[model samples]
Target: MDMAETAAAVVDRQADERVRLVVTGMTCGSCSARVERALNRVDGVTATVNFATGIATVDAPRAVGPERLCGVVEDAGYEAAVQSGTAALDTGPEDRAAAALFRRLVVALVLFFPLADLSVMFATVPATRIPGWQAILLALALPIVVWSAAPLHRRALTGLRTGAMSMETLVSIGITAATAWSIVTLFARPAPVRGHGVWAAIMSADSIYLEVAGGVTVFVLAGRYFEAKAKRRAGGALRALAALGVRDVTVLTGDGREIAIPADELTVGRRFVVRPGARIATDGVVAQGFSSIDTAAMTGEATPVEAGPGAPVCGGTVSLTGRLVVTATAVGADTRLAGMIRLVEQAQEGKAGLQRLADRIAGVFVPAVLALAVLTAGGWLLAGGGTDRAFGAALAVLVIACPCALGLATPTALMVASGRGAQLGIFVKGQQALETSRTIDTVVFDKTGTVTLGEMTVSAVHTDLDRDEIVRLAGGLESASEHAVAAAVTAHARARHRELPPVTDFAALPGLGARGRVEDREVLIGSPALLDARRIAAPPGLRAALESEQRLGHTAVYLCLDDRAVAVLAVSDTVHPTAADAITRLHRLGLRTLLLTGDNTAAARAVAAEVGIDDVVAEVLPAGKVEVIRELQARGRRVAMVGDGINDGPALATADLGLAIGRGADVAIGAADIILVRDDLAAVPDAIGLAHATLRTIRGNMVWAFGYNVAALPIAVAGLLNPLLAGAAMAFSSFFVVWNSLRLREFRP
Candidate 1:
């Protein structure tokens, strides 16, 4: 099968069962790698651990359980727990982790200033060098390097035992080397010496590095804390929606009595009542009453939609006026809101291609950094640099090259972008979707339901037979077919006939029409071309009727009885008001759009012109649609196919990026790379714009992070940079990466 066939077969795609575990105590990319290796050592388990999200997605045998996988990680010297896929996640653990980091930062900052002041006092002036002044500096920094920096120390020890290197290892070594030097200087070194310059004061054997220890701790904690806060705040919109939980709703019992009960107790086919200003209890089709529902909270639609009989309403939309009797279609986790939340969460958890490269680099970079630090210290001593100079430069190198910023570059940006995208009513399936969206230059739209509203109505009907009889016979034959034109005829007949004639020998032709025996007469309901194929000549008047509809941009449906054309029905579907605006926006992004459909050329061109589309390809079958997308790709166009979720599956899968425009209160779960929850064409541009911005942010962040290490390492190696400055730069580099990524939260299309 081709790529499109593979993608379109998403529902039938096969894979081993997967389990996700929430792991703890992983301090950096290396820690995660170690845990991953440990889990993979088990006989039937393949695992990937993501350091940014602390999630280990594992594929294992059915005999293996989640708890056992957690045990594997725990045995590798970390904490782990199973996170259920179907349940709501508890943010309590994340909150607690952030709070702990904040407390450590506060303690380190409180002590850091005093330690710096006392160290300067002991070194810069002879008069202020009182007895025990150096000891006092060490005492002030004691809590920071011990308690405030405890997590780093603990993780470093864990890494040592596992034969792995992490940022925590480099940081712990930097702090240890600095503190050990200070203790030795406090007792074994000479008394305080006043010097002429700043370098003369601290570059000698008598220098106290207590301040560097405290500063690094404060900076790393501050970066981690900021990242935690950004993640929580970025996801605020989704959390609030998820928290819109089950509430008491009035149910209309079988005997026509209303009783209040939890919405969870309501099942499919049960009728529920929604009063004015109240939220709909669940996903349902309106059985009675009329109302305008505020769907902004669920779908990000600014305008309200009028709901009456047969209108599908989402679970969380507010009923603005009139009481509604709705029969439930979905409940519990099957609701559209729940599916959206899950999609957003899944997107956040996915690791981008660049992020995986960063992880691989981090896995090896730490050990290489350790070796480089050793080489620098030894090289300095070999070149006649004194012990004081060699030790200081070595300590600086260790502190300056932590690799934390490299690890933070991509996943944090993806996390913020996913949450922000959700707020705009776009749900990306994964990082791969975002990556694909970034490259789209051509957008292909399915005309029906994509560019124009799919709902069609009878515009004009022509027949010599009794109008009622033609409507009845045509509607009966068309009802057995699920084509869009057939639906229009069926619905038009439904309003007048109330009951359709029973159809016998019913057979539906895929892209043509349907035929059956109705009330002892053979009936054929389809396009005029279908009649010609069966050796039935179209009467002159009926042929003129088809010509008139073609000129008027209407779909002409022909009804044939006993191999003679009898009547013609004209069906028209309205173009969405937002479609022109959506096309304008896509054009602004420098993208070309083409409208592809199975309708006649005139009808397709009319809708395309109304929407400002640049090209139109009409009279295409479902299989032909795939070939069109392939032809576009063969011309080197990076394509994004937009369609209604149900009928355009193959074409959607064929494009480089597939965007499914959602229906009112309905969510499509497969084929498309991105599913837009709003019933608005404008979401297409919004999604692409957001994807562009997110990728730009990620690229900028990586350049900054990699650039920082490249520039800072040389200065530290030369012993020209101060240890305190090295500590400060290393500490804030991660914070800078996260801050750059958070800018995506403010993105607007």
Candidate 2:
């Protein structure tokens, strides 16, 4: 093949195996489009842009790496960086730039205040029409426009060139139109004496009003900067999770030598050596080593985990002692650490109910504002108003109707509240949970470990045969199982130091129990249902013990021989230490709490009373929980399901808001919109408080942003206000909205 054909073939091969680089830097929609265009131009590349988060993920040839991509972005007069296969905290270099912009904006505003007063006086009084004063006013306005508003001008031009209409477009067009109209009239020669128009031939210092124009630009830009910064800060939790991946690893080669290599270069099935005091490079299993791994990063439990052969170890876990050869099971983004980071980022990015409402409103807000401006201008001209009056009316309509406030109210507060939540080990999915938590009137809690400690302690053991022998044999069979009840049984036997025989043909029956052949004798350990199916007869005394245990809300497991019940073992679950206090706190906050469980009614009711819960739904299957939540919702109450189990998944997803106890089952976490990482029931109340605070702040921002526009629009259009004063008011309005949203960052809960 020819060289060109060979090059094309190589490009196709690279494209087939390409992995996208998830990048961040774009600030506006135009930036998104620009990045997409530039990346698509590369020989073997494809890209997708998310304007909301300003992230662009590009799939490209390895030869056209991230450094080359960053160069392309810089060349286009913007910024870009390679994501280090890690989660990114929202606040970064962009926040610093915003701070600098804010400082410049504040300085510009201070300078414009005095100039605003002078311009108003000059417009009202016809006496200060001196040419020298007008020249000085115009000259002073020049620096402010070109210097203070330069960023907006440059951005606007870039956006227009890329065929995208940005917020800067509206601001630049309004200010430039106003300034050009004033400058033309100021230098215009005397036209005539009859029916003279205002600003027709009169050269007043108010004509250029450059301070007013530039001040508006500076303030709006400042607000935008701070708003973006707040969002970045709020979203940084996921970035911290992403940074846990090990940077380098010690690869054990076939030559029996070890060499340092990048973690990304290590593939599945690779043998890597993790020395004492070194972190593991990937998710792997110990093959020829033993050590205690510090898993505090993933599990949040400070105690180190003992790992010998066949024990699992994740990337970034520190090996406290002993050398180990590990076989890599997962590498790169497939590692458990990477998966956790992905889940956090995905959960944060996912929109909740309230944000969807705001976005729908915003979709039509811009077009309506443009139409209103057009109508206002047309109405003014029809009423015999001059071009200057018509232009002023149109500008007022555009400035007042801008969705600047509406667009910011929800996401800004969510970012702030979620950021604060992360600090306390609570992960709120997004604005949806924030809004849902505030509105939920009823909180539903799962019984196991959520409302009660899931620990199953052995309460009593009874037998028809020799109690010691029965107990020993039962414990030996149970020791092989991982179930909670099995652990309790095994502990009892271990304490007695009884040598229990082994079991063969071991089988686990879901929700019923386990069975096996012990010492060539068939032994069955299970619930009453399992014993009934096998036609085992329980002794009268053992039946009484089972009844007593059931009445007290304890689980009774039966140990049986070939056809007779040999022993009765009971296990009881206790209420959590903090559960009662958390329930009381929720009640004080005006929320009603309920308990739902798969346990029998007697057991559920007993636990509910102990926890001081007013409502109870007992004997619920996984599907039955959904019905219970729906019934509560139908009673005009918003329900929040708090659980941590696969059975809880249905109810959690069906509720208005699902709060998952982080220590619960994986499926529970997967279905939940809010995760309480600390697994403390008290965090439930804390999350609720954060939600209310965040929603309150969002409303405050909306009221301030929209309220300012409503109050300022009439004054500007009625000719009672000059552009300088109007601009200042507008600037303060934007700043007020942003500052109000920032208050959510301080939410205590």
Candidate 3:
């Protein structure tokens, strides 16, 4: 089989059993990759590691148990625990880890500063170097190295045991070597101060690298502390989403007695009561009462949606203004809120394309650096440089070459971007979507429920009779039908509070006009074709008016009395108020916009003209929609499909990027790479703009990370940098990458 087929087969085989693991001691992307590789090495297993959330999602055969998965991660030099219950979403352990790191950083900072000052004092004034100065320096460095750097050493040992190397390995090796050399020099005979030149000073065995050991430990600890805090902020959106679900609910029993219970305890077919300002406990249909629900948290729409009898209300939305009796249709993981949270979490856990490359490099990076350090020391000694000089240069080389920056470059930027996207009501499904969005040149929009409001309404009514009388007649005939256009007419009449006279001999015609005797008049209501088929000739002005409504994309239904055309009612799906502006914005971004719909050519063109879309592909079936996307791709156009129906599913999966509206079918939402929770077309442009910004940030971060290592490596090898300076530079490199990625949080479209 080909690569795609192979992948599909693998997905099919592994779809049955999946486990989520919360891993600890992952200092960089390399560590994450290592764990992933180890899990994948197990028979019939596949794993994806997310560095940002510290979560690993492993797909395995039924034979592989969760314990085996955890064992694989543990063997890969990390702590793994199967994520279960509410703990799966909890960040308590991470927060505690961060707290411990912060405390270590504080203690290291307090001790390292004095050690640095004393080292500088001793270097300048030999007289200030007391008889037991070496002993005092060792005393100061011991606590910082043993306590502040404990996590690094432990992780390094774990990596070594697994035959892996990481940033932690580099840090541990450098600090241990420096501290060991300092202790050795304290007891050994001091080299004679033969010359006052810089080379003579560099070769002095009397020099104690106590400050280098302490400073390096302190700097790395501080960097990790900040990194941990930034990662927490990046995951804040998913946590907030999880927090939105109501913990408790009031369910009405079949006998009408109300009992409060946990929201998770409410099952399908159960009835729940929601009062004003209270969140709906689960996804359900309103059984009784009326209220306007604020769905901003779930849908990102600012306007409150009116929910009356039989209207569907989802979980995590607040009932505004009135009480509601809701019959639960879905609860717990089955709710839309739960599905959204899962999508967001999965997105955050996925790695971008560039991140994989970084991980590959990082996987071998520390070992290569170790070899380079060894080679640098051996070369210096062979060139007649003393042992002290060679060892110091090697220590500097080990300390400066940090893979931490490269490992952080992509995931951190992606994390920030995903969180910001969620805040804007755009849920990016994964890193691939964020990367693909920047290259999208064409945006294909589905007409119904996408560009238009997807709701039918009466736009215009042309009738010689009284408008209210015409509406009453149309509503009276349509009240017996369940068609959308019929509902629109009936709803309009009801809104106007027009009373309908009882009709006798009401005869319904399938796809034809309905004829009934209303107050002794034969009333006919249906399409214009129904009038023509009945041999009823429309008046000259009546024909012209009906044609005008049809040309304007309205569904014109002719009303006749006693076999004569009396009125033309124009009903159409209303276009969203923001659709035109959103299309204009997409155009301004240099994207070609197209309307893809199953509507007739005239209707599609009319809607396209109003929205300023450049192209229209009308009268296409669901499969044909996928063909359109494929054709666009064949023309080298990277298309982004925006839709909200089950018919849009194949096209969504076929497009380079798919954005599904929140109110869309579950299948379409599942197929899409991005979800527009606001059901607004404006979010399309915003999502693309944010993607561009995020990609730019990732590129910037990569350049800095790579450039820092390249420039610093040569300087350290030339003996221009000592271990202390190298540690500072290494710390700065990682800090700079993370800080640059944090700038993404300030992004505005």
Q: Give the whole-model CA lDDT for all candidates, comma-separated.
A: 0.82, 0.71, 0.85
Residue 401 error for model 3, in Å? Answer: 1.3
Supply the global lDDT for candidate 1: 0.82
Model 3 misplaced regions, further than 4 Å: 1-15, 86-88, 191-206
Model 3 accuracy (lDDT, Cα): 0.85
- Please, what are the lDDT tens digits per residue for candidate 1 over residues 1-749? 99989876763333346788888887666677678778889887788776767778888876677778888887787889887643235778889999999888898989999888777666566588778876688778999999999999998898788676788899999898888887887778745665668777765523667887787788777767887776666556667677655579899978999999987788999999999998898899999999999988877788899999999899988999899999999998898888887887778666788877777777788888888888888989999986767888888888888887787788778877877787788988888988888889999999878787878988888888898888988888878878888888899889998799888999988667889999999998777668768988888898899889878788887889988889989989978878999999999999999999998898989888878999999999988999999999999999999888455888888889989886621332388889888878899999999899999988898898889989998888888777777877876888788788888989988
Angstrom error of the Cα, residue 572, model 3: value is 1.4
lDDT: which is higher, 1 or 2?
A: 1
| Tens digit of per-residue lDDT, candidate 3, span 179-204 | 88877766785333334665455334
Runs in model 1 lying further than 4 Å from the true structure: 1-15, 41-44, 85-89, 191-206, 247-265, 458-548, 556-570, 664-669
Q: What is the Å distance of residue 360 in model 3 from its true position?
A: 0.5
Worst 10 residues of 2 by lDDT: 189-198
Model 2 C-alpha lDDT versus the unseen true structure: 0.71
Every model's TM-score: 0.85, 0.70, 0.94
